[model samples]
Target: MSNPQEPYQPVQPAAWPAEPAGQPGNPGQHGAPPLPGNPPHGAPGQYGAPGQYSSDGPFGLPGQEPPVRNRRKPWTILGVVVGVLLLAAVGVLILVNVVNGATNHARGLADGFTKLVIAGDSSKAYDDYLDPALHEQLTKEEFIAGIKTLKMDRTCKPAYNQVNASTENGTKAADVAGLITCDGDKKIDLAYRFEGTDELRMINIKLKPQA
Candidate 1:
């Protein structure tokens, strides 16, 4: 038998199959597979750098735009409410001023009419201050005759107590009440009615014994 114990021969190991290109064991090769629809390493594709993922997509896929929000709805409603409140407040202030002005005007007119009567100028009062309808019912001579019997003191000033205004049949009207000090310190309660805003005219006057 061929020398049974011949010198030992070490068999050379078979070379590992050449590692495929881009595989883990191949140091000089890129091992990872190229991303689909993306450029190879070192060249820019749809993005700025190679092998770099885009933040605009999920897992390197195309991204969708975020949904829009209606950010102005709450602010719009708030603005509308604020505007309405402001307008309402302004309207209330204007109404208060108008009422006050009307009341003061009525008071002045009452004072003037009382002064004329105390001075025994009924003819002038009837012609200038009396309403047309009232003048028609009572003649100027009749008005002077009615006041002639009263003992009025021309020196004492007339004092107004209350003045109130209202809306009557779509017309602005007022009623003024006061006392007139006359001869011998006697007092008489006088009430006057006035109508119209721009051209206030005395509609009636009544004198009563003070209680």
Candidate 2:
């Protein structure tokens, strides 16, 4: 109060050497920077030991290794291989059943046609099972005459033993080959070829007599 008239001289604040650890002289800063794998000062939780880090969270906190997960087991790989093999076996079994069914049906057709001609019922055999192509080439009388030339126009029975099915021109076909046992122990080794469609018809015929 006594120096009020002496002069209006004001005292200045003291300057720091390096701004302490962290404060304003910087942008949006507060205290000192924390050590690695540790939160900043004033955060909860105790500090870790030297060169040690927390591994409580996923993939660790920041400086820790991730968890160890084992690879696939041997039993798991074996199960997959067994499953594939079972499926393939089932497919092969189904295929075999279908082929056997087709072959049996084709054998039935062959049995009917051959028995009819051998039993001297040539007209019915030719009209029912012979193809239109054969009809155009030969009359029904000629067809019967052809059977008679084989000495098969007699009362007889058929013993067709084998048949196989296949595909031809996008249609089902079959071949029936077997022995035809007639009356008096006469055996004719014969094969019949039939082509596919909505109906069964003979495409070719072969016969050999066994004396």
Candidate 3:
């Protein structure tokens, strides 16, 4: 007699096909093109690799170099220094010219005053050029008498030479030396003081024989 239940069959597993050599699915193939920005195999050196330098500079990556500082700073400093020196020179020149002008004017006044005294024009000298303060203290007769005491020859002319000029406390003073042709060329030193700007006033005069 046969059994009524049917017999059970064993299930077989599915078999997958093996990938072809050098294909996209191959596992052992390593000669494929490198990915973007990746260095190829056996290349000279990789970017940012040890013991390698870029074309720009050592220790820096390609297309990067150390920063360059301002190159014009030194030139600019030199220019400024030169400009200041020029201005200082110009200022000195101008000061020299002003001092020289003042000295020349003072010399001229000294010569004129000496001529008046030698000419015995005491009244004109006192009225025109004498410092107001000095005129108040000295009478015209006394001035004339004092000039006469010099015993200068009235017929001979006098020559004046500028010695030096100086400034103190805003007052300009000049020293003038004179030689009288008569009386054996008597040499006299005169000190003249001036005050005011541009318009200088003869403040005082001091005369002495050269030792």
Candidate 4:
């Protein structure tokens, strides 16, 4: 007969709980979902983590646009202003030249008339300022007779002395005064009218001897 309380037989170990079908072992701790392309444990066709598009995705962060600047226009405007001023200056020069030329012409006419009258060539002097009525009415001899009546003293000799000239629009006139000495006896003042042109004409001669 064996002892019923004999030494306990060696006990067998209990079974471990079976790992769940889809859940991987170590991955359960992190609680992260698996990505597409990266390998799960090193098998070729197994699950892999998702990949990046060239290092990162298309939807990145925020940014801004560029700025605009001002442009230059002063040279163009300055050129126009200078051109107008030059034109005005040229116009003024032309006007002044015209006025000066007219004045010189008038003065020259007065001098010519004085010279003609003082020379005592009354025929030439009278003809220079021809009056139609006198030319028509008087014979050439009668014109000489009329001029002789003035009794100009031609002794000490007559000389044109001074002339004053003036003008209006295109019309010009001058007053010429002179000294005449008659045969060394007395001095006279002579006055005459001068009409303007290249051919100056004399009119209205007056002579008065000094007392």
Candidate 5:
């Protein structure tokens, strides 16, 4: 009643209630700082456990950075794949060249030896064409006599139907079979096995007239 008459004084507001001691949200008593290793009031604090990491990162928590990805891994894998393909291509090319080379070598040996035998040069043909193992089986004279017996010495150009080569147990071998036209319009079927690769040597031969 006395205050209302004396200039109508305004009433002061009540102070806020103090937070309880040891409570997490508030600072210490008298607005002091929080203890060591403790976080500020109302802070979210660290999201994950210490020393814990994820490979599949881009951590879900806000404001956190993910682990750096290995940028070179994909490129490394690509390089390896390309290298394998190139090596395979090289291998196939080498194999094809080897097969073709063997064929050509066998053909040259056959043609040269056949020409020598037909021209009646038995000494040169036997020494150059026949394998050493074959020399043990037949003398040079016997081989030339056999050729005369078959009348192959009168033959001309050959038309080979099959000429194939293979490598087995580290040994290269080839087979050639074809028809040869004789001087009298007669035909002879001739087959031969040539051994070795770089310098072919004939191991066997067979000749027969058309049936």
Candidate 6:
């Protein structure tokens, strides 16, 4: 009669449980023997034989499922931050260029007016921003006489500040501010109307602390 404790044979590959240890011709005790050339479970370096690698090792052979890869979340975030800084730097450069252009233009206008006033040709300087109606009525000689007779000397230049431009109805104006130091510390605010390019028609003038 056959032995009563005979081991059950594996019907298919899935039917095999883990084999037990230390048996001759079967390297295992109570389960189906390991398939030919396959390593015994839990043996030293048994899972990866010579010229073979475990799934966990880098550069494993094809057809083997890849191990889960660790993501570098901090490095990804650092790259995004660097990109944003570059974009912000570029934006600041553009803004600075625009502001510089506007400042240079205003300075040129102020300088031109200063030169005209120094030469006792305040009328011509005044014409740059004058409206057509005002230009027709104001004579050039009248402007030259008034400032000259008032002893307005070219001792100090006008300190232009707070320059701005605005529009009202159909008229546009450039508000030029400066200290007109004719005798003492006095401020002169002039709103020069914009007639055309490089043409500022004086629409309003206010002299504070009359000296």
Best by lDDT: 1
| Per-residue lDDT value at 77 in model 2 | 91
For each predicted model, how many residue pairs clash, with residues at least 3 apart or on different chains? 2, 0, 0, 8, 0, 7
State the lDDT of candidate 5 residue by residue for 1-211, as single tens digits.
4555566688999999886777646455575676788786434544445555434334565435565799999999999999999999999999999999888877777777777866778789899889999999989889878777756545466778788988887678989888888788878788889887565688998778877
The stretch of ten residues in a row with the least summed lDDT in candidate 4 is: 57-66
lDDT per residue for candidate 2 within 20-125, as digits (tens), equals 5435564446554555787764343433454654554235465355566665677789999999999999999999998998888899889888888787788999
Candidate 2: residue pairs that collide: none
Candidate rank order under lDDT: 1, 5, 2, 3, 6, 4
Instruction: Write down the TM-score of every candidate.
Output: 0.62, 0.60, 0.62, 0.39, 0.60, 0.54
lDDT-wise, the better of 3 and 6 is 3
**What lDDT is obtained when candidate 1 is compared to the true structure?**
0.80
Q: Report clash pairs, candidate 5.
A: none
Model 5 — TM-score against the truth? 0.60
Residue 139 lDDT in model 1? 90
The residue ranges of model 4 lying beyond 4 angstroms of the native Cα positions read 1-72, 130-211
Candidate 5, overall lDDT?
A: 0.78
User: Residue 94 in model 3: shift from native, Å?
Assistant: 2.2
Q: Write one digit per residue (lDDT tens) for candidate 6, span 1-211.
A: 9768878897765676654455454546566577787668745434455555455544565424566776788789999999999999999999878666655565567668666866777877767744566656766676566556545566655677667664457544465666656556544443332333444455444434344
State the lDDT of candidate 4 residue by residue for 134-157, as single tens digits: 456655566556556645533446
Q: Is candidate 3 or candidate 4 better by lDDT?
A: 3
